[model samples]
Target: MPAKWVRTFAERRPGVDVELVDCAAAEAAALVRSGTVDAALGRPGVNAEPDLALIRLYDEVPVVVVPKGHVLTAADELTCADLADESCLLPLDDVLGWDARPGTQLSHRPETTADAVELVAAGLGVLVVPMSLARLHHRRDLTFRPLVDGPAAPVGLWWSEPTSELVDEFIGVLRGRKAGSSRGTREPVAKRSAKEKAAARRERLEAAGKVPPRKPKGAGEPGARRRRGGR
Candidate 1:
């Protein structure tokens, strides 16, 4: 979803170049705090600094990645109980806290989720992770199924003080706010009701000089200029 937003932002802001920085989820907050990046997309539930601003994006559910043709694939989804008999590989970076112990635990946990996924592909064991991570490290030999009872992963946008217009624009886009809406320049005033229609007509007449115009502010003052500006 952020990628899609980036594309839209780029079109609207053609001169601005957006660079994506890849880092461990644990490092995201620090990177933002240190000013290494203008903003960071921090992992869910990671308490941010008091000075930082946070906007919650969405929650991603946990899923299990298993080797192709595994019996668990027969079901559309699975619960922790259903996976109790299998060997579950818990990656070092695993985020979800399971309600039920998944399966016989592997003696050695993989160093990373990607490695855990490789092990799953090799038929060594199953790996559980957030749906986004599973898709990120997707393998042709492996497939995923949503874990119905697993914990959710909430993601958010983080930024520091003295925010820029670019950050405001991105936030607006993320929240589905139309461009220029903040400046009262995009949407026309609703004229559905008779009262509203009459007001709108009066405004049009004023704009067109059909009605008597009010005195311009400071018209008789020395060196007073009209309001001329572009947004």
Candidate 2:
């Protein structure tokens, strides 16, 4: 999805050279705040930080990748209960924050999801991750199934709130809001109302002596001035 966003952004902004930086979801906000990168795409809720403005792109469906011909593949989808007996291979960089204990927790944790995938291939345990990551590290012996009750990994475009025009353009691009005249777009001029237009026309006519001057309200009307009789 990040790749797709980058390609689309490049097509829309031909001049801009979008560079993809690989960092864990936890570290993306810090990298952006430190000015190492102009912007980043990560799970905003998972990596919430103060003063960082974010635009949510989309949510990634969670899937558990297991070895080919695994017994769990019987169902079209599985919940936390179905995974109770399996040893879930959890990496240090795991993004899915499950409230319920998912499967059997391993005593040793893998350093990364890629490492966990290797362990899964070696029949160590199953690894639950975003569908994107499953496809990313796809292998002939591995397959994934949707974990229906799992939390989604929401994608977001994050940067400093008061960012440069280029960064704002990228934000709009990710949001599908602009093709051109991107951010800081000028507001459309409002058309004059019928009453206002008529008033202006009457004023122009009166100024040119084309119509009689408007007179003050008579004494019968509300807020009318009383006559002094001496003047």
Candidate 3:
């Protein structure tokens, strides 16, 4: 989605370029706060640091990942209490921060999500994570079912003070604003005159090869002298 938005922004502002910087969920807010990145896409709980502007995007659904043939797999969805007897491996860096984590606590928590997922795959425990994370480290031997009663992760756009035009432009794209919309453009282009509209359309057509290059004024008129005729 960010890539698509970048492309759209480039098409409108041809001189501007967007670069995505990868950061851990725990560090995303600090990266933006310290001016290391123009903006970040993350959830509010971890990425919404104080004084940073945030625009909530959407709610991310929660899911529980379990090995194949796990009893939870037999059901389409699960609740926290359903896995009370199972061991839950909680990474130290868990971003979701579920107030009600499922299952029993692990004897030793993993250090990161990848490690926890590995433990889950090894049948040491099951993990409750966002559906996106579950899909990120997907394995053929593992599958996830929705956690019907879990907290929904609220994802958002985070940026620090003195936001740039490019950041605002990307925000508009995420908000579904058209290129010519007032939020994106200083003035709407929809009210352009017919002549202005026709000229722009011709330029676009010429660029796209949908129409022949326009002839120079009077170049083919009957009385006009050809460039190389009778030479």
Worst-scoring 10-residue span by lDDT in model 3: 218-227
lDDT of 2 by residue, 95-136 (tens): 776556588899999999999999999999999999988998
lDDT of each: 0.81, 0.82, 0.84
Model 1 reaches what TM-score against the true structure? 0.75
| Candidate 1 C-alpha lDDT tens digits along 54-88 | 88899898898998899999999999898889999
| lDDT digits (tens) for residues 70-105 of candidate 3 | 988989989888888999988988878876676788
CA lDDT for candidate 3: 0.84
Show where candidate 3 strays beyond 4 Å.
186-231
Which 10-residue window of candidate 1 scores lowest in summed lDDT?
182-191
After TM-score superposition, the amount by which residue 194's alpha carbon in candidate 3 deviates from its true location, in angstroms, is 14
Q: Tell me which residue pairs clash in candidate 3.
A: none
What are the per-model C-alpha RMSD values against the true structure? 11.2, 9.3, 8.8
Where does candidate 1 clash, by residue pair?
none
Which structure among the candidates has the greatest TM-score? Answer: 3
